[model samples]
Target: MKLNRRTVLSGLAAGSAVLAAPMVMAQGAPRVVVVGGGAGGATAARYIAKDSGGAVNVTLIEPTRQYYTCFFSNLYLGGVRDMDGLGHGYGTLAADYGINVVHDWAVGVDRDAKTVALASGATVPYDRLILSPGIDFKDGAVPGWDVSAQSAMPHAYKGGSQTELLKAQILAMPEGGRFAMVAPPNPYRCPPGPYERVSMVAHTLKEINPTAKILIVDPKANFSKQALFEEGWQKHYGGMIERIGPDFGGENVSVNPSEMTLDIDGVVEQVDVCNVIPAQKAGEIAHAAGITEGDWAPVNAADMSSKMDEAIHVLGDAAAQGDMPKSGFSANSQAKVCANAVLGALTDSRVFPAKFSNTCWSLIAPEDGVKVGASYEATEEKIASTGGFISETGEDEATRAQTYQESVGWYAAITSDMFG
Candidate 1:
């Protein structure tokens, strides 16, 4: 059966409505300072403010007023969506949800003082801190590639202008030219993202330059929805996409922007375009706060509270939650769970058990979409998946088309939930 976003996300939306009851505050409201006003932070801030009524003060700290979602970004690359459609402002989160939206980088986290120091030199004290800062590239994760060369070969993983730049580059590629992608390793954000991107790029090239080629230099042995994506690629974009995995020297990679050269072990190929999506770690603030044990900050599986400090909670890609794939839906689900737990601790309200779900839909072409999803329950150790489903390789055309429609619905609903 095809999974509809409305049906899958009904629990999340309804949970917010039910949990959000106006509260009467006795005195000053407890303050929650949220860093990274993306999926997890925005939802957490909105839910806490709405449900707590005037009883809890919520402040959201984000560097940008407009956040472009990483989810569905590949569609924009494929010319299916536009930049304006991808951009969302925090005005509603501030004006409607009563959250103190601050557009500033959280420079330092003084856990001892229970305060967050802003890049603007202001310190905001908080009863609890919510950290949802997303992924940051690991320094030198890929040889011969860094931030300075991103214009030549964009990751476009973060969306916004990066997505635009990549699209422009793809359009400008010479006829019969080659496009290369340096796919990230295991445990990166959005496990199926690289393959979906390859599909999108192939879609665009087929329309403009059918002779062009798309090369995926993947180190991993396999990827999410591997069979489904492989089938779709063969059916829709036959002879356009070539994925070279570790068995074929995909691991040893280096790039030269000056010469437009990509080196895979002993073999060197010159490509017109390159996308270097290197290794990633939790965002900078997570390490700045000293919450991260290694690449990611460890959190309590039940509440997403930082294992280091009970007063701090980490969510989204930055958090090391068990069995949860790092996706927009997962982050939003974790946010709701974190909000309920945080507010319950502060306001002495009822805290319900955390239930989470995530669905990742990727479009191979027009009306040809594939998806994988799971429902999770908070176990004593991790956010363990109870059951899951993925789009079958031989599913009917109608089902694939319906899945695309479901993704469209999800983008609208999830964005509204985050920024509404």
Candidate 2:
């Protein structure tokens, strides 16, 4: 199946409701309130609104006026792309799809009343709610680091100003300075994000300050595309990057932003710049909705609906869906399945079988890229991977360059699919 938004939306509106509770009997058009306007929420809202043809009332609540993609923000650090290219406005979503795009933070979700409480003190009711609020760091995940220390250490995990700030810090580093990264643990957003970031930072330092060093304090023994990244680092940035995994006290780490020092195990090292990507949890709103278990919201594989309440759906990094990595492509893929199932419930449209695919592309150096991907199908237990592919260890320069070009194309296409 194509699984594109249009293709999923093309289901004829003449079938019986797929779900036991259709919500078609609601007094007027069924209302869907979506929280978070990133990949999952935006795509779901757009697909539902565009395909329903004004048959459904859709509202998207997001805090930021301009959404910046986390997927390609690493390139901005590498100086391959600019900050301007990363920003996207919601004007098109509103004017073209007839969506109500509200610029406000969603503070609380009242499942009992089926209402969402916004920071502006307004309450929006919904027959169904989709929460795609992305990842937030766990409190004390890194003992000595918090939001207050971000200005000094700068996580830069989320896009926009944090990313800009981190870039500025990297550029401001003195000659032969050190750049350190505290990589997150398992089940975090963007599996290869920290590694790719290390590559980008290394790329920049190589150009301006070749003597600078990059240190990675990773809790995990292994990471996504480890061999590919290691090979690239050795080839492009030899002897400049070093990684300390759990076996070397990487798991026991802390930071002193004010002192510009990192404490790995009992040893302390002063660093010029520190990028701390702490352990993560679902965004706050998901917890408020009473839908999350531990740190993530669990969802049904077929439709991305919350396990706690059927009326609510969760997506993206916030959702604990099986097999799929927490990535922009994964979120976009899940959104289509959720949209199709939602339309089937609200408009009596045909609901197709749930299928998903995700590919994560990482740029190791200029014009050098590697990727990992899988196709998935919804089984009774979870979304199971059917097959997969990954870039080889020692590919030719031409092949790596081709992979980089392919990633560039994907960025363009996925952004268009999102903002449009």
TM-score of candidate 1 to 2 decimals: 0.94
- Provide the TM-score for each candidate, comma-separated: 0.94, 0.94
**Candidate 2 lDDT, tens digit per residue, 1-420?**
766756534442332222111233234889999999999999998889877877888899999999999989999999999999999999878766778899999999888999999999999999999999999999999999999999999999999999999999999999999999999999999999999999999999999999999999999999999999999999999999999999999999999999999999999999999999999999999999999999999999999999899999999999998999999999999999999999999889999999999999999999999999999998877788999999999999999999999999999998888878
Cα error, candidate 2, residue 35 (Å): 0.3
Q: Which runs of model 2 end up more than 4 angstroms from their true locations?
A: 1-27
How many clashes in candidate 2?
A: 0
Tens-digit per-residue lDDT, 1-420, candidate 1: 666876545644554443322222335779999999888998899888877876888889999978999998999888888888989999877655667889999999998899999999999999999999999999888888999989988989897888899899999999999999999997889998988999999999999999999999989988899998999999989999998999999988998888889999889999999999999999999999999988999999889999999999999999998998998899999999999999899989999999999999999988999899999998878889999999988999999999999999999999999988
Q: Which clashing pairs does model 1 show?
A: none
RMSD of 2: 6.6
